[model samples]
Target: MDYLDLKYTPKEDIVCTFILKGKEDKKTLSSKIAGESSTGTWTKVLYSKKELNAKVFSINKDTIKIAYPLELFEKGNIPQLLSSVAGNIFGMRGIDKLILRDIDFPKKYVEAFKGPELGISEIRKKTGIKERPIVGTIFKPKLGMSPKQMAENAYLVFSAGLDFAKDDENLSNQDFCKFKERFNLITKVLDKVENERGRRPIYAINITAPYDEMVKRAEFAKENNGNCIMVDAITLGFSSLQSLLSKKWGMLIHCHRAMHGAITRSRDFGISMLVFAKLLRLTGVTELHTGTVVGKMEGSKEEVVEINNFLRKEWFNIKPIFPTASGGLHPVLMPELIKILGKDLMITSGGGIWGHEMGAASGAKAMLQAVDAGVKNIPINEYARTHKELESAIKSWKGFEKENYNYKIKH
Candidate 1:
C-alpha cells in the first residue's frame, strides 16, 4: 500500500506529530509507521486498497507529520480514534523509540464531540469571581476520613475564602466516607457559607467509578445541590468522561490527571500530557489538571505554559477549559505561578494549604493572599507583612524554586 502524498491535503484530516528514532532509514520506517497506523501492512492482503491509506504530509529530520482522513474516525469516539492513530504503530520492530507529540484535530471532527459545559467564564460567573486565579484546596489526609470530618474540613477552607474545595483524585464512593453522606454534609457547609459571606464556593465531588455508578454519583451530587463533580480522566478513561457529559447534569466537570504520569512522564516514548488535555477538552471537561512548573511534576515551564494556552484558546468554536495547576503547589509559589499562567486558571494546593503551621483555614488564607499579591504585583515578602497566614507560610516553606531538572525519573 502507498502512503506518502506530499502534494495531497485532505479537506478534513487528523494531523499527528511523531518523533522517529530507529535503526532503519527514517523515510522507510516513517512510511511503514504511517501505513501500519492507517491501511498498510508488511504483506498485502487479497483486497489491497491505496486511496484509503493515511498520507505522510511532511518529514523534518526526526519529526514526521501524518494526516488521516476524518472519515477514518468515528464522529465523536475518542477510544476508536486512539485505536487507529496511536495503536499498533508503537510496537513496530523497525522503530526503537517513538513519541506521539501532538495532534492537529480537524474542525469537522472536533465539532462532533461536545466541548466543556461550564468553561472559564461560566465558572467565574457562577463563583462570582471575575478576575485572579480561582483558588482550591484538596483535603489532605487523602483518605480514611469520615464524611463528617471531611465536610468540617471543607467548611474551614471555603469559609476562609477559597473558591473551591475538592476531594483528592483517589477519593471515590468509599465506605469510609460514602459519596451520598459526604455530598450531604458539603452541601450543608456551602449553604451556610453562602448565607453568611454570600460566597458561592464550589465543591468538586469525586465521581470516579463504573459508568452506571458514576452516573448515579453525579445524579446524587446534583440532587444534593453540589455544583461540581470530579473525574479521574486518565484512569477512568476519556470515553467514560464523554458518557458523563452526555447526561447533561449541568454540573461543572473537573478532570483530574491522577495516572497521566505513567504515559506522559517519558520523553522518548508514550504520549504528551498536552495531547491528553486537548482530547479531554473535546470530551467536555470544564476544568483539567495541567502540571505546574514550580510543582513536583515533571513538566517544564515552557510545556506547562503551552498546555495552558491550548486549553484556553478558541479552537474550531470549542469552548475553553480552565487549566488547573496542581500537584505540590503552595503559597510561596503562587506569585510565580500567576506570572507564568495568568489569572484564567484554577490553582489547588494539597500540602500547600493543609501543611500550614496555623491550620487549614490559615493555609487557605495564605493561598488567597498569595494570589492577591500576584495579581496586585506586590512582592510576596511585602504581602506577607500584613497577612499573618502568608507570613506563617513563608516562615515554613521557603524558596519556591523547583528542585532538580530531569526528564527521566530517578527512582
Candidate 2:
C-alpha cells in the first residue's frame, strides 16, 4: 500500500491500459475515451453523476467491462486518480497507456506534487543560505587531477567557509584521478569538515564512468562515504541513471547534463527539458542542471524557472530535488538568479570562481557574499564594503551589474 513505490503514468494524450487484478476472477475491460466507442468493442457506463458524458467506470469478474468518456478524466486527473486508486490495490507493474485527443490538462492534479520535504526553507536550514541560491563550484573542466590534489582542494574549499564544491563530470580514472581514490580522499575531507563545521560541505564526487565501472563506483561510494554522487547523465543515458539511483544513499543525486542541450536547446527542438525533467525525477536524479539564465548557455529566465518548477514540484512523495544553475556563472548574478528561481536552487560558478583575484576559495566566499546580498536584497558592490571577498570581486568584473535576463539566441 506504499503509493511511493508505484507512480501512475498519465502521460499526455496517452490512454493508460492497466490489467485489472484481484477481487476479480479474471476481468477484461475495454477502452473508451469520453464515452464513445472510439474502438470496435466496449461496454459503456457513467461515473460520478456526470450525465453529459460517460466519464469513467470499472469492470467486474470476466463478464463485465465498462468504459467512460476520456473527458471525465481530463487534465491527466483521471490517470493520476486511476493510478492512485489502482496502486493502492493493484500496484503499477503492468499498466498499458492509451492516447487521448482534445484532452484537457488536469488543473486539480497540476500542482499535485506541490508539497516540499526540504523545500527552499529546509534547504536553507540545511546549508545556511537564507535568501539566494546556495553557492556551488565543480573542480572539473579537463578532469585530470590526482586524488590527493582533489582531496586537498576539497579541504581548502570547505575550510574557506564556502558552502559546497564537487568533482567535475569527467573526473574518473585515466592515468590520473581514479574514482575510488578520489572518493576516498574527498570523503575523508568531508569527515574533517563535519567535525569542525558541525555540518560538512557536501562533495558530489563524479560517479559517471563506463557502465560497469560507474555502477561499481556508485555501489562503493554508497557503501563507503561521500555526501552525494555526480553523474553526467546525458553520457550515461536515461535508463542508466535509473539503475544507479536504485541503490540507497544519504547524499543527493547531483546531475550535470554534459550533453543535454544538444537535444533540448534547439528552437523547433527535439524535446523539452520539461519532458526530460519529469523523466529524470522518475529515474531518481535528486539534483539536475538547468543551465544559468544569464550565463554562457543563453537559457531564458522563463525557461530556467519552468525547468526549476519541474524539478522541485512534488511528484508523489519523492523528496524535492534542487536545480543547479551553472554555465558561465559568478557570484554577482545571485540576486537575479534568486528572484527568478526562488530559493530551492544551487548556483555554481567555475572559471568565475577559479579565476577570482583572491583565489578559488575567496572566489567561493565572494559567491556566498553575493547570495547574502540577494537574500538581504542588497547591492553586491555595496555588500563589498563589509565582506572582503565580495568587495575584491566587485572591484574587478562586477558580475552583479549584468542584466539577469537570457540573451537572444543568435542561431
Candidate 3:
C-alpha cells in the first residue's frame, strides 16, 4: 500500500505531523505510522482501498506529515477523529518513541464545531480590563473545604483586586464541597465583591464530572448567574468539552490541562502540548491553560510563547482563546512574565498568593500591584519601593528567577 501522495490537497483532510523514532528509515516508519493510524494492518489484506489510507505527504528527518481523508472521519465527532488520528499508533512495536508534534485541522473540521462562546475580547469586555494581563488566584487548599470556606477565601481574593478566582482542578462536587451549594455561595460572594469593587469578577467553577452531571451543574451555575465553567479538558476528553460548548451557555469555558503531562512531557514520545492546544481551541475552549515559561512546569519560554501565539492567532474566524500563565507564579514574576508573554494573558498563582506572609487578601493586592507595575513598564523592585503589598510579596517570594533552571532551545 502506498502512503505517500504529495500532489493531492483535499479540504476534507486532516494533516498531522509526528516525530518518529525507530531503527527503521524515516520513510518506512512514516508508512507504518500512517497505516496503523488509519486503515492498514500488520499483514496486507486481500482488498486495498486508496481513500481509506492515510497518506504521508511530507517528511523532514524525524518529522513526518500524514494527511487523513475526510470521509475517514465522522462530521463533528472529536472522539472519532482522535481515535483515528491520535489513537493506537503510539503503541507500535520497535518504535522506541512517537510524539505527535502538531495537527492542521482542515477548515471543514474547524467549521463543524462552535468555538469559544466568550473569547478573549468578549472576556476582556466583561471584566472591563483592557491592556493588561487579567490577574487571578486559585482557591488554595485545593480540597476538603466547605462551600462557605471556599467562598470566603474567594471573596478575599476578589475584594483585594484580583479579576478572577477559580476552584482547583481537583475540586468539583465532592462531599465537603457540593457543586450547587459551592457555586451559589461563591456567586453571592462575587456579587457582593462586584458591588464593592464596581467591577465584574469571573469565578470559574469546576464543572468536570460525568457528562450529564456536568451539564446539570452548568445549567445550575448559569441560573445562579455564574460567569465561567471549568473542565479538566484532557481528563474529561475533548468530546465532552464539545458537548458543553454546544449548549452555548454564554459562559467562559476554562479548559484546564490537568493530566496532560502524561502525554506531553516526553521529548521523544506522546503528543506535544501544541497539538492539544490547537484541538482544544478548535473544540471551542474559551480560556486554555498554557504554562508559564518561568513557572514550575517543564515548558520553555519559546514553547509556551508558540502555544500562546497559536491560540490567539486568527483561524478562519474562530475566536481567540485566552492563554493562562499559571503554576508556581508570584507577584515578583509579573514583570518578567509580561516581558515574555505580553498583555494578553490570565496570570494565575496558587501557592504564590495563598502562602503569602500576610494572607490571601494581601497576596491578591500584591498580584494586582505587580501587574500595575508590569503594565506601566515600571521595574518591580523600583515600584515596590512605595507599594507596601508589592514590597511584602517581593520580600517573601523569591519568584521563578531564583530557581536558576533553564532549557536549551533546539533549532
Candidate 4:
C-alpha cells in the first residue's frame, strides 16, 4: 500500500515564523524550492538571527509546505519528497526548540485521516439515538470500592441502559482496587449486558501514567478486553501520545484535558483547546472532552460547540473524533447538551449516579431515558412514562425556577 502524501502544497495563505535559538543562516536557508510549477509563489526569508519565516497563500502545512503543487517533488513518495524539500544542509545542530508557529491548511490537506471509526452518524445509528445524545456515568472518588462492588455498580448502569461509562481520570493502581482486578470485574458485567441486553457501553479506563508506564496501561486495557482507553493526554505530552499511536494500538483514545485550561482558559493569550484538538487528532486520539454546555463547567455553549465542530469537520486525512461532554453532568441536562453539540457526542455524569435515590442502577436508567428524549426531541418530563426515575425527578424540579438555573440534577 502506498503511504499518504503530505508535502504541504498549501492552497491557502500560510505564514510560518520559527522562533529558535540556533544561528540563522540567511544566505543558505533563504533559497526557495519550486513546487509543481516553476510559475508559483514561493518566498522564504531568514531573519532575527534565530528565526526562519516563509509565506504562501493557500498552502498545505502537514509535513512541509510547497507554494506550488508538491507533486513536483518526486511524483509521489511523501516522506522522501518532504525530506528533499529541506535538502541536506547545516540542519540546526544545537537547536533547543522548533516551533511551527502557524500553518494555513489548504482544501486537500484539511482531511488526510478519516477522523473517527464510529463518527457522528455511525455512533448515533449504532446507539439507536437520533435527535438525542448518549448519556453516561463515571465511577468517581477514584478508589476504595472492592472489585465485586465495582462490578455490581457497572452491572447496575449496564442493565439500566446508559450509553457510555468511564473511570475517573485519577482512577489507577489504587491499593484497595487493583487495576486488573477492577478491569476483570467490570468486563464481566459489560459482557453480561451485551449478552442479555445487547447494550455495548464504552468503558473509558484512565491510563494517565508517566511516559513509560502509560504505554503499559494502554496495552493492559486492550489486553484485558476493554472497549477504549482514556488518558490525561495533556499530562502525558503530545509526543508521548504520538509514540503510542505509532504502535497502532488503535483503541478508542479518550483524551481528558485535565490541565489544558492553564493555557487555553485565557481568551487573549496562549493557544485554544481547538488547536490542541487538531494536533492530538494528528497523533490519532479517538474521543476528546468538550466540556458540558449545560453541566458544571466554565465554558459557554458556543465554546463547546466550537471544539466539537473542529473535531467533526472534514478536510484531509485527519479523521473526526468523538466529542465527549462531561463535568458535573446529569440526565436532566441531556436535551440541551444534544442541541448544542449534536448526537455525535459522549455524555458523562458522575456523582449524579451514586447520589440517586434508588442507587446507580436507577440513576443510569434516568440518564438513558433523558438520552431517548433528546434523540426523539421529546421533553424529559414527557419521557417519564417509559422512564419512571426520570419522570419522578423531572416532576419535582420541572416547576421549580432558578434565576440562574444552577439547580443540581441529583436527588
Candidate 5:
C-alpha cells in the first residue's frame, strides 16, 4: 500500500503531475491517487506487485507527480491510458478537487501512436501559404444554413483571399444541411476558387458523428476532393480522434474542443488544456483550437502560450500540430493575436467576418488586411487608412481596446 518513492527516476514510465486538494493529508491523498490510478485498492489485496504500482516520486505543496509503469498502459490506446492515470481517482474518497496538470509519455509509448499525417509544414506547402498565420473563419449563423447557402458563403471568403473556412463545432448532419450535400457543394466552390486564385483553400468539413458514420463521411470527403476535415475532439472522444487519424486520409484534421470548458474551465478540478493538447498532438490532429488570449475565451496569455508551444514543439517522431487561436476573434484583434502566438498559428474568426458592416467578402478582406498589417509590423489604424475593408472593420467593431478585449460578442 506504500506508493511514495522519492528515489524513483521514471525512465520509461508515463509520469503524470496532478494538483490535488482533499480533507486528508498530502502524503495520504497522494498515495491514494497512486494506488487508485495504477494498482492496489482500498484494502490491500491478497496479492500485489511493487513494479506495477504508480509511485508518487515528487510532491510539492498541493501538487504531486505519479510515475506509472509502462506495462500498466496499452501501447497505442489513449482511452486505456486515460483510464489508468485520469480515471477512478477523481471520484475516490477524501478527495474534494483534482486537476490532471500534465503528462510525460515515454518515447516507446509516444511512437506507438500515429501522429499527424500532414503536419504544419506539409499543410503550409499544400495550401501554398508560406508565411503569415493561416487565416480562416467559422461559418456564421452556425446553424440553419442550407448546403447551397453554406457553399456560397464559403466561396465569398475563399475567393476574398482567406486561407480556409470550416463548419462551426456544432454543425453536423442536420436535416437542413446534410453532411454529404454540404461537402459536395463546398468542395465544388473550393475547386472553382482554386482554379481562379491558383491556390487551393482548405475547407474543414465537420464530420463528427458515430464512429461508422464519421468514417463514412470522411471517406466521402476524401473521394470528393475535400482537403480538410473537422471534428469536435472533446465531444467525439480521443479514441475516435485517434481512429480517424489512423486512417491517414491525407486530409488535414482540425480539432475543435467543443466541450472542453466543462472539464478544463475549473482551475481547481478536472483536466488542464495542456494535457488535452499533448494527447491531441499524440493522437495526430493537424490543427487544434488552443485559445485566443485577448479574445472572448477564458485562457490567459501564459497558459495559451504554453499549450501552443507544446503542440508545435518537437516530440520524438510525432508531427507538430498547428495551434488554432479562435473564439471571439476579429480583424482588430489580429495584430495582438499574431504578436502573442506568432506566425505558426491558425487565426479563426466567426462573427468577426460575418458581421462586417459591408458584407462577408469585405469582412474577409478586412481580416486578411489586418493579418497583413500585423505580419509587416504596421499599425492597424495606419494600414486601415489605405485599406477600406480594414478601415470599415475598425469602425464597425469600434477598434481593439486591450481593457475591453474580453467583452463578449454574439458568436
Candidate 6:
C-alpha cells in the first residue's frame, strides 16, 4: 500500500521524524516504516482500514516525517505510544540504520498527561534561590559510602551554601548503606542544617526500585518529611514514572539519565536524547540531566543547547523543567556553563567537589564563589584574586580555558 502523501498536512496527529538507511529504495523503506509502526503486514492483510495507516507526508533525502493518527494511542499511556512508534521498526530486515530524531505531539495528546508538579519557577520559589544557577553535587565514590559518611557529607555541603545534593545514580540500598539508614541519617543532617543556617537545601534521595518497592520507598520518604526523590528514568521505564507522577506527592522528581548514552550517542542508529527529554518532561520530571557542554560528556555544544532549550520552552500546559548540567563538572568551568546554558540551570559536581585539595566544604564554597563570579559577569581569574576558596579551587583544577568551547545563542 502507498504510505506517502505529499499533499497531506498533519494537524492532530503524533508526528515523528526519522532518518533511515536501507538497501531497499527510500520510498519502499519509508512505506515499511509507516506500515509496520501502524497497521500493515508482510503479506496483504485480510482486513485493513485506510484511516489507521501512518502517513509519510514529508521526505527530504534520507530524512522523513511520518504522522500517526492520534486515535492509535491510548490517552496518557507512554509505553503503548513508544511501542507503536519506536518499537518493531528497529529490527526490521534490509534496513541498515534508523534514527528517531524528534517528535511533535498534538495539543490534544500533550494535554492528556500531567507534567511537572513543581517546574522551574516553583522550584526556585521553594528553594528561595532566585537569580543565580542552583548549585548542587553528587556524592563521589558512588558506591560503598556508609550511612554516617553519607550524612556527614550532606551536612558539610548543605551548611556550606550549596543548594542541592543527590545520591549518585548507582547508589541504592547497598549493604554498607541501607536505604532507611541512609535516609534517616541524611534527613537528620538536613534538619540540623536548616536549623543552623535558616535555609533547607534539597537532597534528592534515590528511590529507584521495582514499582511496588519504589512506591513503598516514596511513602517512607513522604512519611519522614522528605521533599525530593530521584529516579533513573530510563531503567525504571516510563510507565513507572507515569504512575509515580499520578500520585501527586508534590515532591521534586529529579531524573538521572544513567544509560542514555547507549541510545543517544550513536549518530546513525537508535533514538535521540531530544526525544527522551521531551517524553520525560511530558511524564512530569521536575529536573533532568541535560549535558554540560564544557564538561566531559558526549553531546556537542549545539546539541546540548538545543536539548536544554526544548526542556525549558513553553509547551501547552507543561511546566518548564530545570535543565541540570552534570558529569565531570568543576568550579573552573562555571563561567562557561552559565554562559552557554543561561542562569536558569542546576550545576552539579561530584569529583569536582570531593576531590578538592582542602575538603568538601571548601570545594562547595569555591563552587558557589565561581557561580557568583559568573552571575556578576566578572572574570573568574579576577574574582579569584580576592576569593581565597576560588583561588585554591583554581589552583587545584586547571585547563578548562584550553577546551575553547564557544556558542552564540540564536534569537
Q: Can you give the lDDT of residue 214 in candidate 3?
A: 92
Q: Can you write out model 4's per-residue Cα lDDT over 24-143, one digit (the tens) per residue?
A: 332122222222112223343333221122323222222223243433333212233224332231143433333333333444443443344445655565557665556777886557
**Candidate 5 lDDT:** 0.90
Stretches of candidate 5 above 4 Å error?
Answer: 399-411
Model 4 ranges off by over 4 Å: 1-51, 54-132, 395-411
* Superposed Cα deviation of residue 6, candidate 6 (Å): 1.2
Better of 1 and 5 by TM-score: 5
The local distance difference test score of each candidate is 0.88, 0.61, 0.85, 0.61, 0.90, 0.90
**Which regions of candidate 6 deviate over 4 angstroms?**
400-411
lDDT of 5 by residue, 20-60 (tens): 99998888889999999988788867778887889999989
True-structure Cα RMSD, model 6 = 4.2
lDDT of 2: 0.61
Scored by lDDT, model 6 comes in at: 0.90
Global local distance difference test of model 4: 0.61
> For each candidate, how many residue pairs have backbone atoms clashing (under 3 Å)?
0, 16, 0, 29, 0, 0
TM-score of candidate 1 on Cα atoms, chains taken together: 0.96
Write down the worst ten-residue block by lDDT for model 2.
95-104
Q: Per-residue lDDT of 158-242 in model 6, one digit per residue for the tens?
A: 8999999999998888798999999999999989999999988898999999999999999999899898999999999999989
lDDT of 3 by residue, 225-254 (tens): 988989999999877778777887988888
The residue pairs that clash in candidate 5, if any, are: none
Which structure among the candidates has the greatest lDDT? 6
